[model samples]
Target: MRILYVTTSFPVYSETFLQREARALIKAGVEIEIISLHAGENSFEGYPVIRFNKGSLLKLLYLLPLAFFRRGGALSAIAREMNVRKPASFLNFAENLLGFGAAIVLEKRIRDYAPDIVHCVWASAPAAFGMMAEALTGVRFSTGAHAYDIFEHGGDWLLQEKLKRAALVHVSTDVAADRIRDLCDSGKVKRIRRGLNALPQAREPRETCPSLRIVCVARLVEKKGFPYQLEIYRRLKEAGIDFEAKIIGDGPMEEEIAAGIKGLGLDDRVALTGRLSEEEVLEELQWADLLFHTGVVAASGDRDGLPNVVPEAMASGAVVIGSPVSGVVEAVEDGVTGFVCAPWEPERWVERCVELQVDAELRRRLSKSAREWVEREFVADRNTGYLLECLEVVSG
Candidate 1:
């Protein structure tokens, strides 16, 4: 069956998990195509990755013809479904409009693809685009709901309508699934776990240390809670706990993190090693004793829906120190698999670090459990097979 992914962009260096899952689905005999609104690689894993020319509001011209001349008030009906509060959530509204305009620009290409499933990679504008495709081509549409899609301020503009309209709504976390259900009385929401491309063998002799070796893999964003991570490191240092940290990845907060490093007098102990490739990340994971994912709910209501690094870190045999947000808790059972603490509590985080440092037996047991957990619940082929089965049922 043909499955087309609708998204804002494709082949992003940071979004390797999406690429991994798409590759798995293709290997399992499902035909896949992608239409991205922004420019990126032309293809991924030998499948077409069509890019659309997303012009400015002037490009809203492409939509006017479709919305006004034809489609029988489809745009108006979609508009009517929206309940976005102006000024408060204008960004969400603007994003959905941009998604719809991009859809209009690529409507012909989407129709020619003739997909059985127009699967949106997000619940916001990408889903809006998929819904528009459904209105135009009569194809079944599905959406993915994550933290940002159904979080604070009541999610997207047309989230409820899309939730009801979609044949399926894939959510990576129980938190997201529960929120989606509350927003829309639709049975389409499905809790689907994200999986690794292939399980990374936990390196032997898990960690070699004189000092506590910690690594963090995340974009420098508000939701990532880097400030809290820095606070924990500071407290650990002050408490005479010898440790070193390398924060992998970079973003808008690069300068801010740099300043934090200096301001906290952690310049010697902490290093912000910009972005690293997937291979390099694994290398870091192998070198570290724990992967600290300090995530929180940001001001924009954005949070992580189980960052891929958590499972990757776990599968690599490094114990995870993830916040108790979204599905991080699902894979990371506190004290059993790894440790969980509130991002705001730097003292608790420092204590967990100390506990891991002192207890080698506990570390070994948790390492084994983390790897086992990934093997049992996060194998790409197995999870993607289930996804394929669900899609096949929908295709029928």
Candidate 2:
């Protein structure tokens, strides 16, 4: 089968799940092509990529005239008010007008390639373009809704219409699937959890450290609860615990988190190692005694459908302690694979950290179980097969 995949951005550093799925599909004898907004490079794992130059200064200049003028509602409505005759063509005229122009080039490519299905990875902007392309070409279209796309971007009638038009709707967690089902048909929604490749041989436990090393692999954002991680670190310091905390990933909250680290005088104990490549992140996961994730709903109402980091950490043989929110509970087994803590309570997080810190046997048990769990359920091959099954059901 031939599949055309569409997404907002290409070569996103941390979202290896999408890359892994595409690779798995291709390896399974499916022909795949991806079109996305270029981030930096235009290459990924031998897959054909069409990169749209949205960052060009000329495109920004083109956007300037439309930026101040276009208001709310349907793009067709905005174009009608602006007296543009081809309103549907003028839709998405600002913001991503350049991408729309790129889509024209992409549509020609699609016609030449003639894929069996068009699969969009997000519901907001990409789905709009994918649906339009499908309508024009008569190819079957589908979408996978991540957290932000379904919860934040799906309230609009336009977005809802695009979703309804999809042959199937995929979500990473049951929570997200249930929510999307409320907005669309339950029969059309599929829950396919994100998966990770098996880790290389588990690292031997560190021999020299006096206390355990706790690591978190996530973007330094408010929703990721970086401040809460800092507070937990502070509590551990105050309690005179001998532990090291490291955070990997970069975002807007870097300065704020750094300030918290300084204010708590945890410069030595806690460190933020900006953005790391997947290899670097895996190295951290392999070395750490435990993975501490305290994800919560951000002020903007953005919540995780499921944080991919949790499964990756678990797959790498680290015991994962996560927040008890949304799809996190599905990833963690609480007292089995890892502990779940309240989002705001640093004391609870610290308690779990200390529990694993003091008990090597407990850590060993959880780590062994975590790896086994990932192998049994969240391996990339199994989950990607499930996704293909969903696609088969939809296309039929």
Candidate 3:
């Protein structure tokens, strides 16, 4: 089957799951083309990509008129859809207009290359574009609702519209699917977990240093709950716990996190290693005794849909400690594969971290179970095979 992937950005370091999914799909003998509204820093590698200019607002304005003329019918249909659901504020109006213009141009580009299915990576702008494309060309489209795409950007009317138009709606976890179902009042959604291509071999009982090495691999963002993790680390330090922490990944919150680090006097105990390549991450995970992945509902209502780092850390034989957010809950069974704690309770997090630090046997037991769980459920080929099954059924 042929699939057209519409996305906000291509080959993002933060969204490697997208690249993995594409690779898995291609390996399964399905034809795929990618179109990113905004280009990314990473190379597109093997896939054929159609990347658009998302640079200057002035340049985008200059192209809007041409886009309108090129696919006027599609733009009008999109405008009507937006008008019914979007707020009437100036910013919202302009944003909708710009989206419509882009969708118009995108629709023209897609018309001649009609594929069996249009799969939107996120249920945000790409899904909007896919909906417009479907309306214009009568082609089938579907979307995967991840975190902010479904919570922060989705609305009652907007989700209803997408649900009605889309062939299938995939969410990463059953908890996320349940939340969106509550909003859209639709039973058409499916749960499809993102999978990892290769997992680190589970560590056997081996002697290590006395100090526990903890690692957290996540973007420095609000939803990631970096500050809470920092607080947990601080409390652990104050309690004279023998541990060192490293936070991987980078984002807009770097400066803020740095300030927090300085203020808490955690410079000696914790380190932030900006963004690292996959190889570097795996190297860090290999030696780490524990992986702390804390997710929270940010002020914008954005949260994680099972942070990819959880399974990565689990497969690496690091005992996982996660927040009680919906997706985290699904991945971590308390005292089983991993431990779950409330984001607000630094004390609780500290206690759990301390337990993992002092008890080597407990850590090994959990690590073994975690790796087994990951191997059983998160193999990329099996998960993407299920995704392909969904696509084939939708295409038919």
Q: Specify the highest-lDDT model's number.
A: 1
Error of 2 at 216 (Å): 1.1
Listed in order, each prediction's TM-score against the native is 0.94, 0.86, 0.90
lDDT tens digits by residue: candidate 2, 1-396: 778888777768867788878778877788788887545247787555777765443543544344324422333442333342222322333423433344444555678888877888877556766665664466788988877665542332244566677899888888887777866787888888777655557544443447878898887777788777788888888888898889888888889888989998999998899899888888888888778888887765667778888878887777888988778888798889888888688888778877777677777788778777777768777888888888876766
C-alpha displacement of 343 in model 2, angstroms? Answer: 2.9
Clashes per model (N, Cα, C within 3 A): 0, 0, 0
TM-score of 3: 0.90
The Cα error of candidate 1 at residue 329, in Å, is: 1.0
Q: What TM-score does model 2 achieve against the real structure? A: 0.86
lDDT of 3 by residue, 287-343 (tens): 888888878888767678888888888888888888888688777899998898887
Q: Tell me the TM-score of model 1.
A: 0.94
Model 1 agreement with the true structure over 214-330: per-residue lDDT tens digits: 999999988899989899999999999999899999899999999999999999999999999989998899888988998998887878888989989888878899999767998
The CA lDDT of each predicted structure is 0.82, 0.73, 0.77
lDDT of 2: 0.73
Give every collision pair in model 1.
Answer: none
Q: What is the lDDT of candidate 3?
A: 0.77
lDDT of 3 at 309: 82
